[model samples]
Each structure stands twice: as C-alpha cells, then as structure tokens.
Target: MRPSSTGAPQRQGVGRRRSLGVWLRGGAPGVWLSGGAVAIAVLMTLGLIGILAVRGLAHFWPAEVVQARYTPPGLEARLVLGQVVEQETIPAERLRSAGIALPPDSGETLTRELFKLGNRDLYGSDFVWLVGDWLQDRQTPADALVLERREWGNFYGYALEVREEGRQVAKGAAAVPELQRRLLRTRDLSERLERLEKQDIGGVNHALERLRLEGRGLELDGRLDATAQADLAARRAELEARYGELEDQLASLRQERRRDSVVLRDVEGRTLELNLARIVRAYQPNAMGLGAKLGFYGSKLWEFLSADPREANTEGGVFPAIFGTVMMTLLMAVIVTPFGVIAAIYLREYARQGPLTRTIRIAVNNLAGVPAIVYGVFGLGFFVYVLGGSLDQLFFRASLPTPTFGTPGLLWASLTLAILAVPVVIVATEEGLARIPRSIREGSLALGATQAETLWKVVLPLASPALMTGLILAVARAAGEVAPLMLVGVVKLAPSLPLDGNYPYLHLDQKIMHLGFHIYDVGFQSPNVEAARPLVYATALLLVLVIAGLNLSAVFLRNRLREKYRLLEE
Candidate 1:
C-alpha cells in the first residue's frame, strides 16, 4: 500500500500500507529487468525479420550482363544438342536444347527456340554447368564447368536410365522367399479349417442318426443298454460344443484368408533405387552460363510466383497455390465473421454474468491456445469426413469411386479455416463489444427502441469499426495458417481450380495448391533443389507480402471507420 501526500491511503498494494517512494524503490529493479528482456526479444525478432526481408529482396536483383563466346580448353571436347559442333558455327539450338537458351531468335529458325519453355527438360539434363566468356574482355573464363551426360551425376542423386519394372523386379526378388512362405502357410491353414468344418458337420449329423436308431430300437421292445444311453448323452453334448468351436474356427479362417490373399502387383520395373553414393560424388560449383544466369534476379521472382504446378521440376508455376490461398482466406473471412459476431453479442449483452458464461469464456480462450495441427485433425474428421461425406452422397452420387466431398478440396479448406478462425474472431469481437459505452445502449432504449433495434441501430454502429478491426485480425490469422490447410486441401499441385467453367463448376474433391506448400515442396522436395533455392526465397517473400497486404488493407479500413465514428463524440 502506498500513502498519498495527504497522508491518506492512496494506493493499495498488499495487506499493509507503504510509502510510494519506498515501494517504487523496491520494485523498480524487477520491473526494469522484465521490461529489458521484453524489449530485447522484440528487437531480436525485428532484426531477424529485417535480415530475411533484405536477403530475399536482394535475390530478385538482376545480375551484371556479360557476353561470352563458346570456347573450350586447348584439349577441346564440347558437348551440345546431340552433336558437338565446331567452336565456330555451333547453332544456338544445339546449346539451347541442352538447357541453355539462345539469344532472342527474333528471326532465327524455329529449331533454335524450340526448347525455350515447352522443352526445358532437353537442357536440364545436359547443361549442368555454365561458363561466361566475359565478351567485354578478350579472355573467356579460364575454365568452364560442365556435366558429362555420359556420366551425369549430381547432388540430387544419380538418375540411372533403367526400366522401373526392372527395379520392381529386383526389389521383389529380395522378398520372394518370405512372401512365398507366408502365402503357402495361409493356403494350408485355410484348407485345414475347411476340412475340419466339414467333419464337424458330419459328426453332428451322425449323432442325430444314432439317436434315431436308439429310439427305434426302444420302440421295438428292445431293451436299450445303459452304456448306450450314457454314450448318447455325452456324445450329444460333446458334438454340440465341437460344432460351436468349428463354426468359430471356420469364421476365423475365412477372415484370415481374405486378409492374406491380397494380390500384390508383380514388379514391372516401375521403381528406381534412390542412389545416394553417386549423389555424394556429384560436383557442386557455383558457376553460370548465359541462360542459367538469366534465371536469377527479378526474372526468378516472376517465374516462381507465376509458374503453374508441373509434374517434375522442368515446367510449371505456383499460380494454383497462390489462387487457393487467397480464395480460401476470403472464404474463411466470410464464414467466421457472422458466427463470431453473433456469439460475441450473446455472450456480452444477453447472457447473465454467472458460472456458465465464465466457464464458456474460459473454454473459448483455451480453444484458441490449442495447437493448430490438432485443429487439422478435427477438421479432417468433422468437416471433411462427416459433413463433406454427407454432401457427396446427396449431391455427387454420380461421381462415386472418385470422391467429391470425400477428398481434400477447396470448400473443405474454407470450412476448416473458418473453424480455426472462429476463436480469434470471437475473442476480438468480445473485446470490441466490451469497449462500447453502456450509456449508448441505455440512450437507445430511452429513445423507445427495442433491445434488438437498439443493438443493431446504435451499439453495433458505434462498434462497427471495432467489429471490422476484429475481423481484420481474424483474417490475418486464418490466412497465414498452413497446418490445417495441409490436412484439408493443399497439395503439391492441382490441375484445375476448385471452381471452373464446367457444369456445377465447383469441384471440391480435387486437392488444391497453396503457396506456403510450394516453398516447402521446392526447397526440400525438388530434385533440382540447388537451383530452386533462390526461387524458394522469392516465393516466401510473395507469401509474406500477400498476408501483409491483407493486414494493411484491413488496417486502413479500420482507421477510416474509426475516424468516421470519432467525430460523433464532438
């Protein structure tokens, strides 16, 4: 407790009263330490973010141009197109086909530009290295690095041009003995069970026949033996028990047979051994020729952001992922806004302050803290499997075998994101609602407005800016989230948008693409990952910018609305 200058208790701090000066002196050190730690953390975070931003932007800068003529060392062996032409008169196409692009063929033959975009693979395979002639200077680089196509190997692993079926056969050979033994064991067990089942039935039928024979003998005035009667009783009970056991064994055998008889496809050479040894031996030098040189800088940014999803690495862009991310975020905003607002309104205005509201408030806050991946599981179960499944049956029965709601797609992505965003929206809206003056509601009621009318006409209007502010926060959170989206819809690639020009154009079963996923796929998964590194940074920057842009727009909108409402206080 701190006493005021008037010698009255001005501040309460515990059970005892204390002078403000003494209290301040005692607590200042601890306050400063905690504050310094916070400040340091904030500064470190900003510094790291600044570095990433700068490095990423720098990657988009164009390299200094150099003109160089094709020349080899005095020993002289150069590989191009399929034929090694003389250093002089080597058609640009010959070099271009091997992954080098010839200068603009504004009037050159079609053969020269044939490999530009449509045939990128032609160059990627042969032209693994580049050398600059440095045309401005008389000397070509003393050395040019190159890949020996005849002996091509790289860090990504060696591509052995072998039949996949041959590989599958080789792998299958390794497992043949074990597989054969299991198959034989299963077949023998099935036969044994079937034989025993037949025997059990026969024994039961024979027992009944013996009982009839004994009954006929008794009816014919013949005395039945006591042993026979005893035997019959024991035999009947034993047979009945055996019958039950046999039935169970037969059922078990049937299930085992079904499970064991899965026909695995024979190896047709459709698999490749991932060669790690050759990969370790691949040359990794940082050198570039004219065509490869062009891939960096602003052109790298443009290609990465604008490319379509391709089969391997030779072709494609990230357009689908960018489209999906933006579309799903917008959809989530549309969905979460209304439900969150309504929930906030009920909780803040209509509900009485009691244990239930307190409990609910605690639960909502806890939900917000749950790890996002857990939300992905929940969405997969509830939204995709439960709700989307039902929708597929009702509206997409004709497309069975192929899933509609059953597969990951855009609608499911939107719904999953909306669920994840709800807590954020609810918390934000509640805070906004809390900040409104109670007198505003009272004034509206005083003017003869119904509770709902007053809420809609006065309270919400005054709180509009805050509501928008809350929604902005919700959208920002939902847009950047990747884990939940991964489980719901994001794939490495997609052929078409969820919505298109065809009849009932929205196809939600198709796994959609997304930018966050693209960065992951290219950086870690690409065979040409060494080259894709710069592209990865370029894509990451785009994603950050997109989310930033969204946040900025919402901030601007909130400010405008806040300004408009503030004037009324005058």
Candidate 2:
C-alpha cells in the first residue's frame, strides 16, 4: 500500500536530521576547522616570506638615476639627481606643519618622493623628500654615475675625467673605461694589502704575543733558563723582521692606490676628486641593459655574502655574523646532545619512579619556559666570571689582569645557548624513549644483552630520528637568539673572525658577530635609518634562510635515520 503524503514527508525529515547528527558526532566539523586553520597559518607564513623577499632582493638591483629640478616654497630652485627610493601620500596639514607651504589649489593629501641623493659628504644627507608637484624637468641621464664607496656612503654624479698622478689620462667619453680599469687595479692592490695586514703581519703579531706569554709562564714556573730566553729572542726577531717587510709592502700599495683618482662633476656643476682605492664599484645605472643589470645584481648579492662591513655596518656583507651564528649553534648542539640524552636515558630507564624524579622532570619542563635573557644574565655571571675567572687564575695565571678566559666570548655564548636549549632536548628524548615497547627491552635482556648495551644498540638506533628532531629545534632556537648572545659574546662588528688560519684555529675565547644581533643593530642602532632599512630586510631574510638551511639539514638526517631503522622499529 502507498504511504500517506504527510507520513512520507515526516520520514524524509527524520532521515535528514539523523544524517546531520551522525556528521557532527563523527567529528567532521572539527576536522574541517583544523584543516582550515592549518591552511591559514601556511598562507600567512608564505605571505611574510614573500614580502621579505620582495623588499630585500630588490635592494641589489641597479636602479636608474634621475635628474630633476625641484623648487621648494620660499627656496631657490635647485638641481637634484638620485634614485627614487620611495613614495607616499600624506595629509597636506602634516607637510605644512613641517614648514612646507602648499598651494591653495592643492588637495588635502599630497604625494612626495624619497630621493636617495647619496653624495652624503656634499649634501650632508643621503636621502631627501621632495613634493611631486615641485619636481620639474625630470629625466634619466645615461651618463649619470652611482659610485659605491668604502666610506662616506654612495656618491652620485657625472663622470668627468680619470686622473693619474695629477695628469688627465682619460676624459669625456673615454673616462668610464679608464676609471673601471684603474678600479680593477686598486681592487687587486686592496686585496693584497688586506692579506698582508690581516694574515702575514697578524700571524707575526700572534707569534710574538705567544712568545711573550711563554716567557711569562716560564718565569712564573721558575724555569726561565738562558737557552729558553735565547730561543724566544730569536723567534721574536724573525717575527719582527717579517712584520717590517709587510709594513713596507703595505705602504707601497697605499702609495700606488693614491696615484689614480676619478674627477666627477655633481649636478650642481661642482667638481670633486675621489681616489680609485675608495671606490668599490662605479656604474651608470641608467645606462645598464637588462643583462648588465642582472650581472650587477648577482655581484651585489655575492658582495653582501662575502665582503666585510664598512660605514658603521650600514654597508657591506655579514659573513662574520653568519659564521658565528652557525658555529655557536653547532657547538651548542655538541654540548647539549650528550647531556640531554644521558639525562633522558637515566630518567626513563634507570631512575626509580618517585616524588624526587617527578619533581626533577617538572623542573626541567619549567626551565624550557624561562625567559632567554635570564639565561644570559646567569651565563654572564657564572660562565664569564666565576668559572672563567677560576680557569684564568689557574691555567692562564701569567696572563692575569688581562683576563683571557674571564670574558664574554664564543665559548660562553655557546654554553649559554646550550643551557637554554637543553630542556627541549631532554623532553623530546624522554618522550622518544618512553615510546619504545617494553617487549623490545625484555627481548634484548633475554638475549643476554645488558641494559646499557640494549639501550646503546637497539633503543638508540631506533631513537636516532628523535634525537635529530630535538637537535633541529635547538639549532633553530639558538641560531635566532639575540638577547643571550648580546650579553655573552655578540658584538656590533668583530674585527676578526673567531675561526681563522691562526694557531688554535677555533678561538672560542674571542668575541664574535651574530646575524640575529646584526639585524637588531642595523635596524635599530644604525645612524642612517633610511640607508640601513634595506640592509635590515636583507639581513633578516638571510638569517631566516640560514635557520631554514640548518633545520633542513637536520631534517634530512632524521629522515635518513628513520628510513634506516624502520625495520627495527617494526
């Protein structure tokens, strides 16, 4: 028999309600929310990275130089030439408040362009803001030059002539090639001079210092024999003779560097002489084709990676900071891994379950939440003062008052970060150890393997991936930590790298630059904010890349270990 229409409708409604109830009960809504949240987070991260890449990477591209005449209210019209760095629209009232008079017909909001007028020495500023309406006769001159310099920031002008020893060797159309050729020569001389000063002479100085320290140590030990003294004197004489030769070569290079100079005429028709040695690279940005610009960009990027800083660190590369960050993170990993794993093994396999053990685990967990700066203070007081001072008093007594080990340095920084990261390692390792089934341990014991042997051979091999996971996390945290390193060993600019060709190749007692601190210094502490802003973005991007690279390496190792030990786990 056919069902009634109302009854059939009621049955259909019942069926729909049942399906909805089942969907809710099955957790489909929660799953959707979780997936959506993860997607949003991934998108946000990608967006942030994209912004950094766009802003930072653009700084290396050569921008066309523009020449224009700007007429400010109540001021004489003047010629201006520079790269247009930025533009913004602001309330006209704000400009008027800052002494800029706007015309009656001007809108409530006005647009202004930030010109990177370089020529810091001539203009007393690297950048200036000019209202869009006031800028007239704008043109991109192909002959306009942008001179990257070692000091006084960038110089923007038109190349006039190349002078060698006060005589005009090349001028007009031929001047750019002559200047480029002379710059190449100066670059070679500069490299040679740097090698002589930093390596050859530096080695001699280091040896002389070692000799002095040895003699002092011998004197303290009551073993300063005449033969030892004679040996020390001969070594000192040889070092001093080598130093004298380096000095002579350095002086000759300096004289040769001063021989060739480039004469440039500013937009204001004023002539200026710049030594070829001072110029890093001179390029006509407006004249460059796409291929030339790309090549220049590559070179600029390479320079940012390899060159030493100049201009109060607002310019140049961050190689030292990069080295220090990686070295410290690696050292921290080395020191923390053994301690963390040992502690975890003892807690999980050896320690009796009791109130004391529980309390210790709680403390370790709490330590992971502590402020990083507190670790810095503790490290400064204990590692730098108490323990380091004692070491200096004992092993380095001859260097007393100088305090070789009793100082904030690479060792202290690494130790501080190790302590900061240990809690993470401990927790991860403990979790990994607890995950292994009891049958695995019991089988190993039944096979006549000792507990220690079981743990070392069977358990550890399976847990290697977890160990690497902890290490990856620790490295990520330590590499980007700036607060602790600021107090421990990080400096604004390190004159020398901690690792070099010198004896005791790894100088743990020396101060080092860190990329995290470099970003902070460049972003906040730089005198030229406008000039340094791009560098800050570039450096921040570099630091993120470095941390990502380190983590990827660890992740790769972890994956390899997991694959190798998959069968054992199964």
Candidate 3:
C-alpha cells in the first residue's frame, strides 16, 4: 500500500478527467431540463383532464333551476347624448343573463320581462319613456330596452326590421353592433307578427267606429242615408280592387320572405336556436321548479342529451353534434387502417430501401409536425372543391346547384382526417414490420412456402402486434384533431343528419355538425358568452369522453392482439 501512493495519484488524475468531461457534455443539465419539461407537460395535461372530469362529474351536482324577471340599471332619466330629461330605461344584458323559462300565452318561448313603466297607456300618468344620452346634454328616447347578466355573443339570431317610409329603419330597440336598421329581441317572430297584425286590424276597426259614431256615417232610422250609402259603396269598390292587385303581386314574395327571413326569436314551434346573451339577460332565479331536485336533474339530463334543434331559443338537445363526431371518427379509422397497413406491407416486404424510402420517411416525419388547420384548409380545397366536383359530375349531374358531393360533409371530413393521420400509421406499422427477424422469413421459405405465403402466414402474424400498436397510436391522434374537421365538414348547426331519407339517403356531401365545432361556436362564436358557459363546459366534457373512448377501444384491440401473437416470437 505504501508503494502505491504514486499509482493512486495517477488514478485520481484519470477520475478527475472523466468528471470534467461529464460536466463539459452537460449531461446533468440536459437531463434535468428534459425531465422538468416532461413534468410540466404531464402536469398541464393532467390538470386539464382533472378539471374536465370534475366539471363533468358535477353534472350530478346539486343544481336548482330558478325563474326570475330581469330589470335593467334603474335610471330615472339622463342626458342620453347631451340633453337630460325624465326618461326611463332598463338594460338589455340583464335580461339575457337572467332569462326565465317562460312560455308565451300561446306556448311560445319568449324571453319577456314585465316592466312598471311599460303600461303603454297613452293617457297613463305612470308611463315611463326610455331615454338615452346624446353625449352630454342632448337626449333621445330609446324605443325599447332590456337588460340582464350574460356573456357577450350569446344572442345573435333575433333580428327586428323596422320599416320607415317603405325601407328598414333602425328604431331604438336591442343594440347589437352588426344589427343595424333591424330589431333583435329573443322573441318569436311569427307570434309577434300575428299579434301586430291583430293590433293593426283593431286600429283600423277603431278608426271606422269613430268615423261612424262621431262623423257623417250615422244611420237615419237604422238605415243609411243616400250620401252615406253612396260613399260606402265607392270606398268598398276602390279598396277591393286595390287589395286584389296587391295580393297577386305579393303571393310569391311572401313565400320567399318566410324561407329567407332572419330568425326573430327562439319560440317553441320555431327551429332550435339560441341567443345566450339574450337568454341571460332574460333569465331570472326561481324561473323553474327548484324543490323537486330529482325531477329537475332528470329533465336536465334529457335536455343535455336528447333535445332537437329549435328556433327562438327553445330547448333542443346536443344529440346532432355527438352523432357527427362519433360517425366521422369511426369512418376515418376504418378508411385509414387498411390503406395504411397495405402501404406499410409494400414498404417493408417488397420495396427496396433506397433514396425513395428515405425521402418518404422524411416526408412522413415532417407531416406529423404540420399545423392541423392547414390540413383542414387543404381538405376543403382538394376534397370539397376538386374531388367533390368530379364526384358530383360523375354521380349526380342532375343535382348541380343542389349539391350532392359538392359541399363539405362527413365523408369528406373522414377522408381528410384519414389522409392527415396516414403518415402516423405508416411510421408505426413499418417499425413493427422491421422488428420481425430475417430468420423467421428464411425458415418459412425453407419449408416449401412461397414468398407471399411466408409474408402472410409467418412474417405478418409475427408483426401483427406492432401493426396494431401503430393503429392505436394513429386513432389516438385522430380522435383529438379538431381544426381540419372544422374546415372540412363541421357546422355550428345543421338542420338534418348526414343520413336522411332523400334520394341516395347516405348523402356524404351535406355539411354536418360536430361537438368540437359546437364548442367553438358556443364559446367564442356565440353572441352572448356568459349565458352559454355551462353549455360550453358540457360540450367540452362530451368531446373529451369521445376522444377517450376511441383511444380505449384501440387499446383493447392492441392488448388482445399482443396476447394472441405472444407465442410467435418465443
């Protein structure tokens, strides 16, 4: 030991050199950084999933439905623009936020609020007029105003067109920036129009009554006088001819107007639509029964899952979007699996590894990094326009402008997503194929089996486990993709399903709706964001479940195949 002191010094020098080299390579720092990054990513993913789960589970939380009336900011009167006066007003947002589920007299869904100053008595002393400020001093009376709490953009469909001098003129009503020269209240238009028609007819009757009682139309001995009779005949004949001519001119116009008319309200009989802002403003606590908690929860569940699309904001369920998502994903998986597996077989079994193979590998890797929205845009361009046009011409030339394959639909969306995910599948399957030993192929060939027989019976069976793993990965990736499908087929709302009883009912060219797009539509695209918050959470939860279920199915298949093929390698 005493003689080894010099040797120990040399060994220590070598150890010091190794330590210095390790530090220079930054191994510790790199590992720490990588681990930290992975930890952060994992935490974020888990946090999001946790939040969704908590919210979804809260679907069973104790919730009470309350109905209440909304009243706007209480302002007696102020200088709307400049001049100040005794003008009465309420806020519109308050009504939207505080909507109560109330049916109109005839069972119409109208977001209505009872107001004190809205007596509408021409001679009433308590009548209040809505006033707005003209900057500082001047004032203009608003035609109408309602207010409640709600996020912006929830209410967009309700539009009012006030005619002035034979043209639509903006009368002070609901104030949405884009709703110029129109009226917008989340109330049913057909009901409103009918009520207005009745009022106008009453006014005409009242004017006639006044003319008869207070003017020259008084009867003499219960019989009309000569001059009165003559005047009545003349007037009747003139009006009848004029009315006849006008009715003829308006026959076609009325039908067109109904078809293209802007939605006025979300009444029960109308289509399923909502203006969340308007709903929130109109919402009120205690609007629905709160005490029967069990019944209420049951109803809410039904509403959440099975309601149909409705107009005037009547309750329709989110079933359509759910169907679209499931159908599209299933179709995409089915379409992609065969094509991807076949491509992998050719690349691994037949094609020689060369520059072309290297180039393909590079392209596949690069494709995985491309932005999803770009895929959507490409799908819209290539599939919807170019390929769809060709399909239409070949299959349904009779339905030119009516659109068969000429519009974005579930089929186009599935195909686009399949194409987008093909590279993932190819990479995974090829890697799986690579794992099969050459000895297995040689053994199969030595036993009087042809190359095809060897590939089918020996090599393929051995590689099945890896091929399935690739499919699982591809499915997992495809299920979560939203951007591309949005451009290809998903819509905010669709009137009918992709499968309907039309000519060639399995029409793949109609624009169908999906849950992911619904989230985007309800959260950001809505006119009122606050009123739609709960709905947004619900939709998000559904989307996560859909994605998870798809991944789980792939996993189940992978596990089964792995177990089945475990003996081959051994």
Candidate 4:
C-alpha cells in the first residue's frame, strides 16, 4: 500500500514536469518577454514626452503676479513683486546650514517659493528664493504690469504714467490705455525700421558687396578696362545713394519709435522710464480674464513659433532653427536618394556574386554603425577642405580669403548628413530589390524590352516604395544629427536664412541654425540657467515634433507608393 502511494506521487511530479517543458517549448515565455519589453519602452517614451510638453507648453501661459511683504530673519521687511515660479520643501536643517534662519517651532521641513523677480536691472537677478512662512500680505494686484522686453529680460511693476518726448501725456488711471495706444504706434514704426534695415539697406549692402567681388574678379582676370572701372564706379555711386536714402528712413523710424516712453513704479517705489520700442508686449496678468489670457497665450505661442529669438535665445521664437532644419533635411534627402539607389541597384543587379562583392557589401553595412562624429571629421577634411577648397579656388576666387564654398556651410552640412545616412538607404534598397521576384525581370525581357529598359521602366517603378522607405529612414536619422552639423555648418545664431529674397536665393554657402543645436545651446551653454531651462524644454519638444513631422511626410509618400504598387507585388 505504501509503495503504491509513493509511486502515485512520483507519477504526479513527472506529469507536472512534462507540462512545464511543453509550455517552454511553445515559446509563450519569449513572446511575453518581448511584448513586456516593447510595452516598457513605449511607456518610457510617452512619459518623457509628457514631461517635455508640460514643462515646455506652460511657459507661454501668463501667471498672476504676486505682491508680498517678505521679512527674513536679520533683514528688513520689503515689498516683493513677481511670479511664483516654483515651490519646494526643504529640510529645516539644510536651510540653517545655508545660513537661513527658521523659527524654533518650524518642524523637520519648511516650504519655500522661487520668485521670478524680473526687474533684473534692479535686483541683479531674475530669480530669488524666499521662505513661504516669512511672506506676509500676499496679494495679486490688478494694476501689476508685466513687460516683455527685447533686452534686459522682463520688467514687473505698476503703471505710473505715459510720456511722449519727456512730457507727461497721460497719468494715473488713463496711463494704461495711452501706453497701449502708443505701443501700437511704436510697433508699426519698429516694423518699418526693421524692413528698412534688413531689406532696403541690406539689399544695398548685398549689391555693394557683389560689385566689390565683381571688380576683384575683373582684376584677377586681367579685364579691368577703363569702361569696366567707370561702370563699376557708377553702380557703386547709385547703391550708395540708395543706401543713404534708406538710412534716412531708418533714422526717422527710430526717432518715431523712441518718441513714446512709459513710467513704471516697482515694488521698491523707484520709477523707471522704459522706451515703448523696447517693450514687445505688456499686460496685467491679474486683471486678465480667462478668455483674454487664452488669447494672449495663443499670440505668445505663435510668436515663439514665428519670431526671431531674443535675449540670448531665452526669449522669442525659433523660426530660423525650424527653417534651417527642414531645409537641410530636404537637401540631404534630395542628395542621398539617387546615390543610395544607384549603389544599391549596382550591388544587387550588376555586380558579380564574388568575394569582392561580398566584402564591399559587408563594408557598406558596417559604415552604418560608425559613429556620426567620425563622419563629421571626414566631411570637414574631405568635403570642406579638399572639395570645397578646390571649388573656391576655381570658381569663387574673388572671395578667396573669405572662402565662400570653402568654409563650413549648409551644403557641406547636408552632404555630411547624406554620407552619414547613405548606408541605411543602400541596405534598405538592396533588401527591397532582392524581394522582387526573378520572374518579373525575366518576363519583361521575354517581351522584347532591353536590360536597361526593363530595369528602368519595370523594376525601378516597382521599387519606388523601397526608395521612399530608405529616404524616410535617412531623414529620420539625419534631421536629429547635431554633432556632424556642428562641425559642418550649424551656428548658434544665423543672421539670415539660407533662402532669402536675393537672386540665387538659396545660399548653400551660408551658416544655418538647427533645432537640435539650438536645444543644446539653450540648455547647456546658456548663462542664465533658470531662464533658459524652460526654453530648453520647449525647444526640445519642438525638435521632436519637427522630426516626427518630417518622418510622417516621408511615411505618407511611402504609403502612397506602396498602395500604387500593391497589385504588382501580388
């Protein structure tokens, strides 16, 4: 009886082991592991994007300005006016170690608030931390004014009076409306000033520079005849006359802009006279209703998207960076697609299946894994120094010492990114070509088409989807590349876009701003850490969106091509 019972238990254990082995062999565990990994990766990505969005998008929202009397231990009570930017709890002991006093009744931890005291010219800092407990008589005054400035960061105070040419135009309750009305005038004048400076004067300067270069070219070519010299002088005189006229217009516009000023009294009761031209926008946040705040937010957001960056790139828009990134990526796609497709076609269709071909294929695959900085170095050496120098010597000799194409610029940046992205394209294209059935080629040949005809009309059309797929991959990789662009062409601030109203408008030999590099510059290299922090987040989010937008465009084209060729594949 005992032996039979032991045998039954042993049999049950054997049955359990068999079931476990079967489950393992079915691959359920591997499937679950892969799914879990993918889920974790997706969750992490979403969390990061959420953080970026929250931190970035909130910067444009106008928060009510707080007025309070703060009394710190051993310090006199003073009025503080600014926005409460952040709040945190710190240990009481830590505060004491930092030479801050806490009351004896204070518990283990004490809360503090960070204020954006934006009268930087007065306080010498944009931010200050004060103990929440020490703040008394906190209020959001409806008359508190926040001035968004082009320089010296932001100014927070109350409106005192509006002035025109040192005369008080309006005061007391009437000043705000008068200031707003005059601000409109200043904006119009400022726009005119900018147009005269950048367009009229800039065009004259461009023409003058071209004339100078032309004369240099004529001299270099030994063609500086009396007629040519006289013609050049006449054109120069004409451009100078135009420039003088534009400068007069610019001076008049500036005088009009500087005509109006506003008197603002800060919390310290000291008054400041700010020119209307310096203030980009002004509003009392506490006085703004929800609808007005929303409208203001939308305008600020639009400005961030379309305006040029100001205040060391901690304020204003990233339009130049956006334009440059898209331009370079498109140029890279245009340059890389044909080269990658041709190489792929050769490797798959023309090359003999030998050891040399295999070795070349292996090398091409390995190039994709190479560090991007290595490509930058190679581009700087070969593309910029070698090829570009040759081009400059041959064609742009008049701009020799200045080095037009010989310098790091947009062309080299695009070319470098193309080289960096080509390997992926080649591999993707090769895979695509390999997938085409051999019978399709043979069938085309049987119908009297030549090899080239069959390849171009029959095979290549079928492979268009593959070409787009490769382009999508290339753009996805290249658009976010910063290290290579930094060495090739990207700059912290590009004064003008690569594309402008000038003849031969697309200036490939000009430096350009990139979204990736802007994020890097604003986040790491900026001197105002607190002010730049929000901009860093905003710019990072923008870059991601830009890359995603570019990828989606390529993806859409790829899908369309795939749909067009779906029947052929079947």
List clash counts for every candidate, in order: 17, 0, 80, 0
Candidate 4, residue 256: Cα displacement in angstroms equals: 0.9
Instruction: Residues 528-563, candidate 2: write the lDDT tens digits.
Output: 999899888899999999999999999999999999
Candidate 1's displacement at residue 455, Å, is 0.9
CA lDDT of each prediction against the hidden true structure: 0.59, 0.92, 0.59, 0.92
Task: Give a tens-digit lDDT track for model 4, residues 315-431.
Answer: 999999999999999999999999999999999999999999999999998999999999999999999999999999999999979899988999999999999999999998998
Off by over 4 Å in 4: 1-23
Clashing pairs in 2: none
Off by over 4 Å in 2: none
Tens-digit lDDT string for candidate 3 (261-372) = 1223311122222232223222111223465446656665676676544421122468888878888888988898889888889888888899998887898889888888
Q: How many backbone clashes does candidate 4 have?
A: 0
* Model 3, global lDDT: 0.59
Cα RMSD of all models vs. native, in order, equals 23.1, 1.2, 20.2, 2.2
